[model samples]
Target: MARGCLLAGARLVDPAAGRDGAFDVRIAGDRVAEVAPSLDPAGAGVVDCRGLVLAPGFVDLHTHLREPGREDEETVESGSRAAALGGYTAVCAMANSEPVADSGAVVEQVWTLGRAAGLVDVFPVGAITVGLAGRALAELGEMAGSAARVGFFSDDGRCLQDSGLMRRALEYARVFDAIVANHAEDSALAEGWQMNEGEVSSVLGLAGLPAEAEEVIVARDLALARLTGARLHVPHVSTAGTVELIRVAKRRGVRVTAEATPHHLTLTEEAARGYDPVFKVAPPLRAREDVEALRAGLADGTIDCVATDHAPHAPEEKDREWDAAPCGMLGLETALAVLLTELVPGHLALARLVEAMSAAPARARALADHGGPVAAGRPANLVVFDPEALWTVDAAGLASRSRNTPFGGRELRGKVVHTIHDGRFTVRDGRVADGKG
Candidate 1:
């Protein structure tokens, strides 16, 4: 008797394996036992997955768990639950914590917390500089060799503006074959900026963050990356100029990869017309032309993945006046729904969307156990979604501790039905499964 789970009659869509068809999958313990057109349940527990789309679980290249200091905003446990509900089995937690993840000790603490949660695999990103000050490099080698085995490093909330220091960080990261993800913004150019610089900012009398601010830093970092011959990742690419820069860099064979956020891809500066802080984000939203360029970049494979810069701020922090409010919004819960309702079957194909959210990020971060082919020998990391299921976003109903979602009260399609992590149900029937079901 097979003592495991059987998922029957799912439209298995694994872009990495070039598989898209109806099939039955059997999971025994942590590994997939078999996949065929039909299978006898035998003694395994059966889950009827007819008409659902089963694909590799999503992997977010960028995420902010906000622990070690801002636990009131979000903790590893709550964020992992949110990610499980959102169809993500793994997330790269950013380096911006209370004390900052600049040292091996801090990153290992984060990794330990994620393991305790047991819902998702949380990989902590090491900080590029001590205290994220950009004045000197942090212990990259120490963190890489830590128990966390950190392979990604970034100063996400702030850009590494010092060119010499940036180059040094790149050179050091290359030695370990780790990634250096930069928050591309020239701080001086974007100082005191409230929103994207354009018609909307002018009308609202808010200081605008010019698209050039992002482009300038991106251009500088690309040059340094070319020089160091190191892997560089551009996070939350916002402008058309940045997109073109990355496209050309890839053509020139610079070792670089880029990601665009869901908000940047679907929304625009128009969302800020109401002066709502939820719509405010770092690097801010850009114009319609920029949004179009981001979509085209993702569609053409220039942007490697869709990363959720899922920064969470408490209501008190986020509900302030336009200028006093903090940037960022909740993303883990709404990412898939928003992409499916807004981009799929139009701006992006269904297959590409799955690949961008799953395989691409997994490959970028070198997460071997994630972004699966759903084969017999692979780990059972998968998400079953109802592509046509429609639901409304409710702020209070979210899993994260924060209530700052940009998609609040909006109806969206493509709901997650179940998420299997390590062959156990993390999410079942659209809710977090109980006691590792």
Candidate 2:
């Protein structure tokens, strides 16, 4: 529970070092002091990690903890609990909160609440536009100077479509050494679209969200990134063409990174055929071919990271008719399981999974404290998981404040057993610790 060496004995998989073996990891006072075979279990808290896979704690580049303004939906506390249960040690809380994390004061407030929550590290992201209005650039430098150390600026859940505004924002954010994270949807092209436009939408009589809506924005943003010579990160990129665009940009030496959500890699537009809003997400799930392409991208390193995009909504809001309901699904709690069950077995290896979930996001968000080789003196944020454990997802029993999981009742392989955050046992044996640290 406190300062001590913890011998986590499972299949230790530190993808950053390409180390995978049945080893022991020792943590001393919030830092990994040793990681090797058979450390003496003498005077340490030997957490029996039998049948588990010990790895670095996950880092999410995209998460919507709708606090400050929409506590009715979620708060930093509830969302942090969800993150802990999901084996995450840190998450980049999005800027699209109630008052919006545009100014330094609001962003600092969000950081304070996250620290108080004491579950996982919540890095506050600053808004790309004031009030997320897409009109004027937010105070990027002020936010970066705040306690939050804001490194990501976004107009997420909405695109910063005003080309001039976007250019200026990229230029301004560069001054703070921050990146502009775009939602990448053309408002005019994606208006009123509920789910991915395709044969399924036509069959269900639902409005379709054409892939071009996302593709067009991604193309424009890449061009802007090249022009401004500023770093850009495209969040929740769901289409194959978008991945190709990012690949080309990287080849051209544009400082850009892109992330794909678990839903985009596993589920498809076919899931929306039943008119279930749970399957509704921004950049709605695409076709099976798109999912395959994304998996290929992850395997080949074309896609940089796998973010949760963990959006939570209250039951009342999510239970409405498909078109009337808010978009998003509970992902933090189920992302790893979905990956292991849906992707790893056939398409990707466990090492690739760890990289996508941890190192890549850490690099993308510039959180140097996270994602690493389990070496001496590194921060002791780690996760021990039972890769062989199979379980069914229960939305009602989740740690999240809201039950909007689309994978409810779905059987999945692999599960997290113990999550160590900053050397604290936030979750032990698949349960959260009793008190807030």
C-alpha lDDT of all candidate models, in order:
0.93, 0.88
Cα TM-score per model: 0.98, 0.97
Candidate 2: TM-score? 0.97
Candidate 1 minimal-lDDT segment of 10 residues: 1-10
Model 2 backbone overlap count? 2
Q: What would the per-residue lDDT of candidate 2 be over residues 1-437, giving only the tens digit for each residue?
A: 57676665678888777788888888889888888888887788788776788888999989999989888778999899999999999999999998999999999999999999988999998998999998888888899998898989998988888989898988988887788888988989977898888898888888888889989988998999999999999889898888888888899999998888988999999888777788888889998888888999889888988999999998898989898899888889899999999887699998889989988888887887788777888998888887778999998898888888999999999888888888888888788884642
Global CA lDDT of candidate 1, please?
A: 0.93
Q: What is the lDDT of residue 188 in candidate 2?
A: 92
Off by over 4 Å in 1: 1-3, 435-437
Most accurate candidate by TM-score: 1
The pairs that clash in candidate 1 are none
lDDT of 2 at 381: 86
Q: Which digits, one per residue and each the tens of the lDDT, describe model 1 over residues 374-417? A: 89989999999999999999999999999999999999999999
